[model samples]
Target chain A: MRWIWFDRFVEFESGKRAVAVKNVTLAEDHLHDHFPGYPIMPHSLMIEGMAQTAGILVGEARGFSEKVILAKVKRAEFFTLVRPGDTIRYQATVDGEVTASGASTTGRIFVGEEPVGEVDLVFSHIDKNMSGLEFPEENFVFTGEFQALLKTYRQQGGAKVAL
Target chain B: MPMSKDEIFDKVRATLVDALSVDDDDVRADATVMGDLGAESIDFLDIVFRLEKTFGIKIPQEELMPRDILQNPDYVVDKKLNAAGLAALKKAMPHADLTNFEKSPEIDRLAEVFTVGAIVKFIEAKLASK
Candidate 1:
C-alpha cells in the first residue's frame, strides 16, 4: 500500500535543507466543487506539506526504521493562497532537536519566492511494539492526485521512487 | 547500466505517442511542446502523470518546463535527472524549489508547452540518462 505522507517527500535530507513539491492541479477530487469556476489548494494541504516534510526529517533522525507522524501541529501560519499550476515549495530547518523520540522543526511553504505558509511542526516516531498498534497503510492512502502523486517522490541528487 | 539520450528520448516518445495521440513526425527535438504540438494545460499535466508511471520517473513541474530544456535540450540531461528522474520529478517540480528552480511570472507560462508528448519525451530522456 502507498502512503500519502511519502508522496509529499519529493526531496528529504538531513541538516542542510529539504524540499517537497505539491503540484496544485484541477483534477484533485477535493477541488471538485470549491466554487466551481476556480480551484485552490486548501490551506490544510499546505500544512500537510509541512507536516510531511517534517516527517521526512523525523524519518531521517530515526533512520527511517519506524513509522512517524506529525502527531501535533504546534503552530501553523498561512501566508498566501496556493493555486493550481503553482508548485508549493516546502523547506524545513531543525529549529531545535532532542533524541529520536521527538524534534521541533521550523518549516515554510513557498510558491516560488513568495512565501505561502509557515509551520512550527512536531513529530513522534513510535515503535509499533511500544505503541501496541498496527495501522494499515491503505487506511492512510490518499485518493486522486495525491494517490497518483504518491508514486512520485524525489531526492535532491536525483533519485527514483522507492515504492 | 547507464542510459543514453537517444534511448531515453525514444522510450519517452513511445509513452507520449500513446498518451497524447501524436505521430512521431510531430515531435521534433527542438520543437516547443506548448508552442508546436498544441497541448492544453490539462494535457500537459496528464503527460507528466504518465511520465511518472511509465519510466518510474517523477518530474518536478519546474524542471519539466524549464526554459533551457526546450530552447536547449542539453540542460535536461543533468546528472541527477539521469540518476533520479522520479525524485527529480518530485523535487525539481517548480513550486517545490523556489530558490533553485527557474521562476516564471507568466501565469499562462504552463500553457506554452505545445505538445504533451514532446514535454514527456524531453523529460524522460533527461531523467533516464543519469
Candidate 2:
C-alpha cells in the first residue's frame, strides 16, 4: 500500500488523536499536471490527506480489530492553495466514541503556523471477516511503510501511541 | 465512599452523552448503550476510559467486555457461546442485564447487554468491592 499523501506521523495517541505531516515537493507527478504554469497541490488530495490522518486515528482506537474506511466528508473548508516546499501538518481528533459502524473526526490542515484547510469526516469500521478477504498477517494501524515512518518518528522524540 | 445509584447514573449518563455524542435525554438508565444510543464496538473503549477518568477507577479490559471468553473451547461450541459460557458470562458480568442472554447467547451478541445502567451498577459494585 502506497501512502502517497502523508509521509510521517509526528504524534500518535492511541485512541484519542494523531498528528502527521506531508511535505509537498515538485517531484510529485500530480503537481505537474494540476497546472501548467503555476503548479500547486490539488484541493482534492488535501482532503484525502486529512481523511487518512483521521482514519488512522479511528483504526488505532479499535486496536486494528476493525477496518476503518473514510465513509463521508461531513464538511470541508479550504483557506489557501498549497505549493511545493510547503509542509502540510494534519491534526486529527476523534469525535465522540468510535463505534463499529464508523467514527467521526475533524482534521485541521496547517502550513507552518497558518491554517490552510479543515475537514470533518466520518469513517466506517469493517471487520476483516466481514470484508471477505482471506486473513493475511498485516499491521492493522497502518501500512508497512507508515509503520516504519512511525518507528523513525519515535526514535526522533515523537509521542508514542498510548495503547 | 461508594456513590449513590443516582450519582452513578448521572455520571454515566454524562460520560455516554459526551463520548457517543447522544442527547442528554437519550442516555436514560435503561437505554441500551450500543443499540439505542448508537454506540459501536470501538466506542466502548472511549466510554470505559471516560468512566475511569470520571470516577477515578481502574476497569480492566477483560472485566469490561471479556472478548477473550470466546477463546475458551468449553465455553464456546459450534462457533457460539454454549450454556456454560453463558453461566461464566453471568458470573463475570453480574452487573450487566443478562436476563435474555439465553435467548441468543452468541459471543458476538454479548455487547448488546452493556446498557448504561449496567455500567453504572458495575462501577458501583467495583467501588464497593474495594
Candidate 3:
C-alpha cells in the first residue's frame, strides 16, 4: 500500500501553515481488518496524515533542501473516531522559526466543522542536525510524488504560497 | 527582572515534563535527561522547541549538546573524549556540571551531563544573557 495519507493539499501557505484533506473510504485494505464490523479509521493513520501535512510544510519552508523527517510526536490526542466517508482535514502551522536543526509544528484535525484531534510534531533536518551520521546526497524525503502534490497545489492557483 | 534559578528550574522542569511525557515528580534536578527521564535524541529537539517557546530564547543545537565537538576526530580518541574534547565540551556547556563526566569521558556517558539542573542552569544563563 502506498504510504501517502492525505489525498490533496487544499490550502498551503508556505513556511507558515498548510491544510490537507484525506477522504476515508472502505476500500482501504487496512480498515477491513482493523475491525470487521466497525471499520473505523485508525488514530495512528490520522497521526501519519498530520505528519505528512506538517512535514511537507516544514520541508517546503526550507525549499525541500533538508531531509525533513518526523523526529518526534510530542503529543497526539484524538477526540473522536473517523469512519469511512469522513473527510479528514489537517491544518498544520509552524510553531516557531524553522531553524537549521529542525522545526516544530502544531496540527489540528477536523472532520468537517467538528474537531477530531491535535498532533504536535517535531521534524529534524537530518543533514544539518545529525552530526556524525551520513544521509544520501539526493533529497530522498521529498520524492517526486510528494513534490508533485505541491506542484499541483501551485498550479491550482495557489500562487500566493511562498514556494 | 531576570528569572531566578528556581524560576528557571520550574519552567525547565515543566518543559521536560511536556517534551518527555514524564510526571512532575520525576523531574528532579539530579535526574539525567536521558537515563532518568528516558529522553532519546529526538526528544532533545522537542525539548529545545518547547524551551524556546517557553522562555522566548533561541537555543542553537550546538549550544545545548555540542555535537560538533563530540564528533570531531581531533577531539575523540578510542570512543572517548580526549583532553581537547573534554576542554571543548567544558567551554561549550558552561551551564552543565562536568565534574563527574570529566573523570570518565566516554562517548557513551556524554548524555549524563544533561541533568535537569544543568538545563535549568542553561536557561538561567540564556535568560540572563538576553
Measured against the true chain A, the candidates' chain A TM-scores are 0.71, 0.80, 0.90
DockQ, Cα level, model 1: 0.01
Model 1 ranges off by over 4 Å? A1-11, A128-163, B1-130
Q: Between candidates 1 and 2, which one is better according to DockQ?
A: 2
Model 3 lDDT per residue over B40-86, tens place:
88888888989999999999988998888888999999989999899
lDDT string for model 2 (A26-102, tens) is 99888888997789998899899988888878877776556676756656899999999999999998865565556
Question: Per-residue lDDT of B1-130 in model 2, one digit per residue for the tens?
Answer: 6589999889999888877778999988788888899987556655665676688777776786765676788899976888888888888878898877679787667767878889988999988886
As for candidate 3, its clashing pairs are none
True contacts kept of 2: 0.00
Best by TM-score: 3
- Residue A52 accuracy (lDDT) in model 3: 89
Every model: Cα RMSD to truth: 20.6, 7.0, 2.2
| DockQ-based class of model 2 | incorrect
Candidate 2, after superposition: displacement of residue A43 in Å? 8.0
Winning candidate number (lDDT): 3
RMSD of 3: 2.2
